[model samples]
Target: MSSAALPTSALAISAAIRSGSLSATDVTRAALDLVSARDGEIGAFTTVTAERALNEAQAVDRLRAEGSKLGPLAGVPYGVKDLFDIKGLSTLAGSKINRTRPPADADAVLIQRMTAAGAILLGGLNMGEFAYDFTGENAHHGPSRNPLDTKRMSGGSSGGSAAAVAAGFLPLSLGSDTNGSIRVPSAFCGLYGLKPTYGRLPRTGTFPFCDSLDHLGPFARTVGDLALCYDVLQGWDGGDVACVDRPSEQASQELAKGATGLRTAVAGGYFRRGADPSAIAAVDRAAHALGASEEIDIPDVTRARAAAFLITNAEGSALHLDNLRHRAEDFDPDTRDRFLAGAMLPASWYIAAQRFRLQFEAAMRKVFSEFDILLAPSTPFSAPLLGQKTMMLGGSEVPLRPNIGIFTQPISFIGLPVAAVPVRVDGPMPYGVQVIARPWREDLCLRAAAVIEAAGVAHMTPSSL
Candidate 1:
């Protein structure tokens, strides 16, 4: 295949495969070769299922030869974060302890959905331990280095998902977002990531992390690809308690409707304070591009963030209580300490946080009633150095790990859908803006993102590496 064809978008690849202009096996081989050549420096994948990928690709080819209809993702190559259960592979969830568990009996709900749609899985990607990190530093499986700048953090716990797409290893990948895993990495790696409305996509077969807040979504190089993945992953699954039993919302079909008549606003108040100037500028550029002059403040956002922390701690601790008792030493020290602390939190604190969450969600709903879409900085700044501990936020140095999701936590805390669109900047690394919409209104978020992408204000320029 020509170099130009090698890095084509997922849609393009699918079309080519359908037309017999490209073979799925060849495309899969090229992707595997790229991963083998570049993953040593990037460390995006924890496991690369070469044989499985090739076999799946060959099946697609055979279907075409037999004149059978193909799925939308016909020959696209993709992967999922380690948390997802890939049949026969221990669902690591970025923890060493999980390696000892028996292999998964079947694929995750999303994995099954993707494969049925004809997208071959490359393998399980690396992630933050137990999905409790935002810096993308996995002590056991070294940090998934930033494709743009190896020294910088890739953002986590979906770091590898974002890094793979950004580095052109694959056109799409699946990731989970509890606080801001999907959006943060999208911001840092210059990819288009979707953290769909909480429960929009089923989380069955994925390891738990703050059950109330955890979400599974996709990372892609383009808004359309993101929407396509979202559409495919839609539908109800009785296996996941949180899965909404609603008909699939055809976001990709609706994307062409554009952002017309949408009431757009830039978030002010808590969102404006303590953000990096560059992050602020990116939001400004996006807001300007979308003709959004109105500024709205989300009520009690700080308290919302605190509530998220308390809820996450309590719930995550509860889920891992047994492991904490038996395999505490197997966890990353940071994760172990946080889980231990959470196990000690009073049940009253968790109850209060849940009660407060309802109030916060109500406030946000009112804001959504007035505005169709809201824009905010995805991260406070661009990717930080891998081992860097402190950052100058609002002129005060703060610990980097927790603060990186400062702008994202409050939004996800309320189960709002957000599309993280990378802002084109004149720096070595990239930054992004969040296009947020009310629950189940991912169409609005994606429409606004498509508009920004068309204007050249937001894009995914593949990393040079």
Candidate 2:
């Protein structure tokens, strides 16, 4: 069967492969063909591992032929953000200098998990330089255009992950979110993306951005597919110090529960301010779909966002101080400047942000004690024009890069789980809403997202590209 004839979801593809209706080799070739034809326009993939993928797919087919039970992701092709280490490929975390690093001898922990579940790896995807920007524009690799509109932005760091899935080149892909990297891109590209609770998924073998805030998760067109990928990727890796040694919490099984008996609220006050009309409308629509009418104010949201910024800058900058000192000119100008500023920050400011972080987490815990889920805008607005530096927010023109994650920063600051579901508004580009749950409660977030998905208010629309 041709790629066009292949089923749209990963689970469906796996079932077809298991039943012998389709061969894993054929499915892998079909996906690679799509990437060959459309990826030039989207700039979604940095590399396409056709040879490696075909070999893996053939192995899956061999197992099925031998009467061995296949894994849940048996023949589904997927990609990961460039930060993830793939054996024999230098992990270019979207920078020019990383091209000189030696090839990785092993795969990232998450990659190992995906391989164990029988998923085929397509290749590495493009991202913002060193996971620093909100806009998807990358100087070394070029911008990863929005699948829905070539001229618009695709949101940052995880932009290629969202673009690849949204464009139908791949059914599932992985991305990292330090501060809204996955959510912002998913919202812009009109896909479902999950940012699991911090330390829930181990980060061994992946490039570091912010040690405390960094998280890796999946992107997909449907909520079930998203959860399926998440379930496969869950486990403890002793290699990663931040990883929590917890058993996998299967979210796919809990999806059918779908917002029943769950207490939900729409975030008000800080969440509503400075947001575009389309963003507010998207949140309202998602809230309505989940039967949430109560408005709740999350305390200290503004300060929480500020604290996140400080922590990210301090921690992220510390990782690249050597490069900033020696190869500053080789760095992306926007990323270099930000890292330089972060280096200048006093130790006291970093310490204070850490102190405030604990207090914020405690406050959020109390909020979660009262409500099961919270709904808010995933971004301030839809994707901005590609390479456009400034935008009007709150009736004043502001620098576009730092402000894109305003709503998302606060929630992630405290290591909460969030699901970003796309909602179509009056505009041509669709915005998204956040389904947030307390730490380690990704099941609740997915259940709420499933309810929104069931109502048809939040779903991925076909990309014109």
lDDT of 1 at 395: 88
Count the clashes in each prediction.
0, 0
Whole-model lDDT values for every prediction: 0.91, 0.92
Clashing pairs in 2: none
Each prediction's RMSD to truth: 1.1, 1.0
In candidate 1, what are the lDDT values of residues 178-201, reduced to their tens digit? Answer: 999999999999989999999899
Off by more than 4 A, model 2: none
**What TM-scores do the predictions have?**
0.98, 0.99
**By summed lDDT, which 10 consecutive residues of candidate 1 come out lowest?**
1-10
lDDT of 1 at 114: 99
